[model samples]
Target chain A: MTAAAGTARAVWRRPPLIRNPRLRWAIYGGSLVYLVLAFASVDVNWTRVYEGLDRGLRFVEGFLVPDFVSRWGDIAQGMQESLTMTVTATVVGIMVSVPIGIGAARNIAPLPIYLACRGIIALSRSFQEIIIAILFVAMFGFGPFAGFLTLSFATIGFLAKLLAEDIEDIDEAQAEAIRSTGAGWWQVVNYGIQPQVMPRLIGLSLYRLDINFRESSVIGIVGAGGIGATLNTAMDRYEYDSAAAILILIIVIVMLAEYGSSIIRQRVQ
Target chain B: MLRLQNLTKTYRTGDRALNGVSLTVEPGQVVGLIGPSGAGKSTLIRCINRLVEPSSGQVTLGDTALTGLGHGSLRRARRRIGMIFQEYALVERLTVMENVLSGRLGYVGFWRSFFRKFPPDAVSKAYALLDRVGLSDHVDKRADALSGGQRQRVGIARALAQDPDLLLVDEPTASLDPKTSRQIMRLIVEICDERGLPAIINIHDVALAQSFVRRIIGLKSGEVVFDGAPNELTDAVLTRIYGEEDWSATIRPVDEESDDQVDDPDAEAEHHGPAEVLDRERMAGLS
Candidate 1:
């Protein structure tokens, strides 16, 4: 009886099993299945990968001595064009999106207008900027104008949707209280909606400007006129070193634009 | 100066929030509407401002028939009436000064109000009102930063800045502690008396209403059960208003006895496992 009592006491004193065994077993089985599938699907061989790595290293070594001395003029011109396209498109996009976004916000605008604006934004957002650029290239016949239009449409879709959401999430009581004070609809929007949304809109616009800069570089690949056009030409000619140089310049330009816009966004907000 | 005749409101859910309610408030009188929850006190107050449009009624403010006016005209008429809310309802992101200045928005242009460029007189009045509410040092603080009582003070300051002839307050003390509730009631009563502006307040506490208001309007199931001076608010009248004797029985003993009787140590020991029981018991003791 004494031994039985001691055993019972020891069993009772043990902590409860808080961790579920079924969940642990399921996770273990899932990982095992994933590993088996990954290994089965891969055609990876150590010898081929090792040989490919050497060739890549040798090709990169050739570009280590960048020959920017002869190509400086071309590089500067391309950079200028890229910066202008990005800035112009972003500015125009933000300027146009303010009204469109306000109209799309159902809390602010009438139902019909909100639906129409939302549909436009949706259409613009559904396609990639390159696809839109291709369409513009067809209509306007291949230039920076095509790229600008594409970027503007894409930015409007993204920025307007974000701005509309910001407007919707504002303190509604402020608007109601302003209305109660006999303020007109315009007055209520101006006082109640504008203050709350302005900072967020500015932040979103700056962030989009940075994204547009990156997108502008690639949109030029379809004869839209930027560094991307030159980069494509270099790649087609098998001038890998020149392609590497252009890639480096594009990275630098994007980084600079991102830094500048981030500073402005912080200050404004 | 404000009158409601046969005011009625029925929701789409088939709930009659206010059923044929009518009352009148003369200038300079503080009228208190007392009722249990869902007794249409809030609906009646909101209907006065046409915030909740009465289904069918005659609502007159001064010489104007409020119920008959068009939206634009009604909006213009609303400027003369100031409203204070239970949650304070000052825009949380805005500074105390800006929230107070918002009361003058009706008189200012859209561009001016947008930029927060209130008239010099309005700005001065906002400062004075803030000072009156003892929130002078907190003029720059955001509305969300302030405590419940301080936010209510800001609400009063905002309403007063409107220079209104009539004030509508809805459950101004419902969210406050007993001490803060009395303070807010005192401020409302003092403001109404000093400005000679008639005010209507919706309140749940009968004792608070009786202590602060000159006239008490009692509502039961969305209809007025009693309307008279605070002195006429008796146990029999309360029973009719609440439709139960439980509240009177609970309240009368507390009112009669100056001290709480539920402070027995043995009873308190039984409430040791959860503090919620003790907290509720303490609240019941206060009431």
Candidate 2:
């Protein structure tokens, strides 16, 4: 017994094994492995990079004049179409999403309805805007309508999910008190649910509108009507200067939408 | 008048919140329910309104059987039975006047309520209730801005706005200080007396309940352990209700006047003759 006690004491006195190593070594090892694989797999020819840089410099030098003087009419038309599609999609998406988002919130809706709405949102979010635009273009024969539909689905996915989360986090005490007044389900939703979620919903919708504007420029590449259709055609014909001008215009529009949406969001919040 | 006959509520997890509890409240009588935490006091009050539905029971308010009713009928029945919560349960974002007017939502149409077009009588009654609750000047203030005592006053006004025949208050003073608790209890008693409304109040403060209510119902572990007049509530009864003998030390009468004089700016400012008389009346009602 004395021998066993001494052994137990010695065991207790011994220092424990350190369980964790410094995570920085793991990061360094991963980076070294990635560098080794990259260097081993890639055919890094310096001559090709130099030639590409020269071509890029020549392209930039050619676009010094911007070429807007001749293509102003087409550029203006494309800008208008893009703006129209963005606004229409955002408004319609917001209108549809309010109900769908409320229905998807588990706290607000029944189990089956919440699950179905969540599934719909998941399906809408799974596809990229370009892929959705391609499908709509094939079905609706390639027009601004197709782009509008694609952006609407995308907007519903993002905005509705955010709005549902906001609804779910609302103060349930207010809802309970309202229900205690013998108010119907609709009345509870209108008075209790709407006031809490409205401000957040407005802010999210404005942010989604800005995102939809940027997406609208690209969806047109899939034969959906917007500035991207013109951009793609210019690129196909090797009109690099015209395509560069269109790219600059698209950037300007996106910047303006971002600023406008920021102001609206600040006001709402 | 309200009566709960053999009411019991067993949750899905098989925990019995209320087990075969029965009680009665006569018109214009304020009965106080006292119990330790998890003794089913809140459950008893909630079951009266069917807010938390009882597993099995008959809760009858006058002529209507509150239990086993359809959803629509239950809702309509709930309008006549006003309930006050421990946390006030006012919609914090809404104005005090709007919170008071919410009491009449049962009678208003959905479209009218959505547009905030309450009837003229409802608006005037809400204004009167605000005045009665001493919140007339704060009608437009948000409910979240009110202090605990003021919020409970708003809660009382909101329940009174329902023109209820039965008032069920669950821990209305639980979150308040002793002074504020006394004031809230006084207000409850005064309102019930003035309107001839029957009420059942649940509280953890045995002394406060004994002072304010004529009848006391003590609960323990989901059962009614003691039911008698407040005068008959002895230390032994408290021990039986709480499952301990050490709570007698905590049941002494509190110095409410000094506490009120220190914290309440309004009470301090109104320290003149009529206010002192009013305070005495409040104290008498509380005791």
Candidate 3:
């Protein structure tokens, strides 16, 4: 009985994942060496950084004494344009994406349709919003029209790809049950697929709206039109206080949008 | 009448799920299909509805040949064939009334169904079916909110909403407790009897199948091995159907269903090990 108790109390240790010690050590040593080499290649301009400290301090002080009263007209107009672009672009992009997203889902659509939809998504996603904004600005001249097109295009790629993946990953058994009922293709999609992905689709659209608003502020730096245009003009004129006020307004709007979207998302879920 | 002549299904992965299987069901007949896991019971049922397209076979219901129909015809054909699933595959997000009404999707137009607007006839029938299933109070409840037996009852209501001539019931009670399982089986059999609707129930439990079904068809590795009345399922016959096991305890007389006392711990132990009981008795006698 004593021996049996001793046997039951046998010690256990977790097995090692990497069986080859040399290979493991070699990989660790190689990563450390590469990291050190990568870090050493960086160049820093200490004198330039020191010289810019006073300018940075002025920028920081501008926030303390914001010139919102002077540039209130410009700020309000820019906010309106940004909000308009965000709303229209989001609505239009969502409308276009719904069909494309359905087509791209492997389980739902035919092989050819899936391929074409995926290709379109890939093309839209490859270019950054700033790059697309630059192209559209060149094509249509500098204004919110260019910004709208860019944001709408970017929204398509983001919304459609995620929506397609969600559709692909849906409960097959639910869809199968619907299909077994002799539901037509449209009927199956309306009942089986829509209900499953509605919440996610709403959540994603809200997220994209938030994203497009932030992006509208940015693309304006390239003269695509928004608050970023006003911000750029202030920067050019060295009106740091006005620039700070515009930045603060942009931040406040984005925060409100995010909070509102989150609340709405919670309600839907 | 429904007939499947030379029905076969070979999946994309080259797995022969069903091979040259054929069977027929007369009007108002309740057939129980018994098989081990992966023995093509599911594939066979799915083929009849053309949900899993049969590689080579003919599925005939009444005078219509179901296999070669175009998209429009197929949808119309599917409306007449009701199916009940094991997991009670109710759309979790939809309400019970909506789920039940989804059965009439093939019959209704796209716009009508989409707006949650069924014809008054369909709406009244849905309400009646819900009441019949003892879920009149829960019509507005989301399908995900129901218990196992209740969810299955809703599934039955949905299938009945189609007013299907033929019913394909796949493992209707697989995920339920023993009593719930029995209740579901009894309900299905009673419903079939009442409406004179033919049904094919793919079941796992041999005894449960024996207890409820009028006729049995045993599938062994994608082929039919036994098709006969429940009483003809002797020990050797069961051995032929389900490889081999000490099936004495598994088999029971149909009238012995009053033996819910079988759930008693004493009876369970006795059924499990007769040798142990005999040895204990012998030891007691010697002592």
RMSD of each: 7.6, 8.5, 8.3
- Candidate 1 lDDT over residue span A1-269, tens digit each: 86877754434454535367787788889999999999999998989999999868856874785555556676677767777888899999999898899999987798899999999899989999899989999999877888889899999999999998888887665676666777788887776777678778878887887888788778889978777777777767766677778888778767886788788877765
Which lDDT tens digits does candidate 2 get at residues A1-269? 86877754444454535434566567778899999999899888899999899878866865784666566787777778888999999999998888889889987798899999999899999999999999999999887899999999999999889999998788766777787888888888887778778778888888887888788889888899888787777777767788788888888877887888788877754
Fnat values, candidates in order: 0.55, 0.62, 0.82
* Candidate 2 residue runs with Cα over 4 Å from true position: A1-48, A58-67, A237-244, B253-287
Most accurate candidate by lDDT: 3
User: At residue A237, what lDDT does model 2 achieve?
Assistant: 76
DockQ of each: 0.31, 0.37, 0.38
After superposition of all CA atoms, the RMSD between model 3 and the true structure is 8.3
**Alpha-carbon lDDT, every model:** 0.79, 0.80, 0.87
lDDT of 3 by residue, B5-118 (tens): 998877666778778888999999999998776777877888888877888989999999999998889989999999998788899899999999999998888999999999
Better of 2 and 3 by TM-score: 3
Q: List candidate 3 segments past 4 Å from native.
A: A1-13, B254-287
User: Which candidate number maximizes DockQ?
Assistant: 3
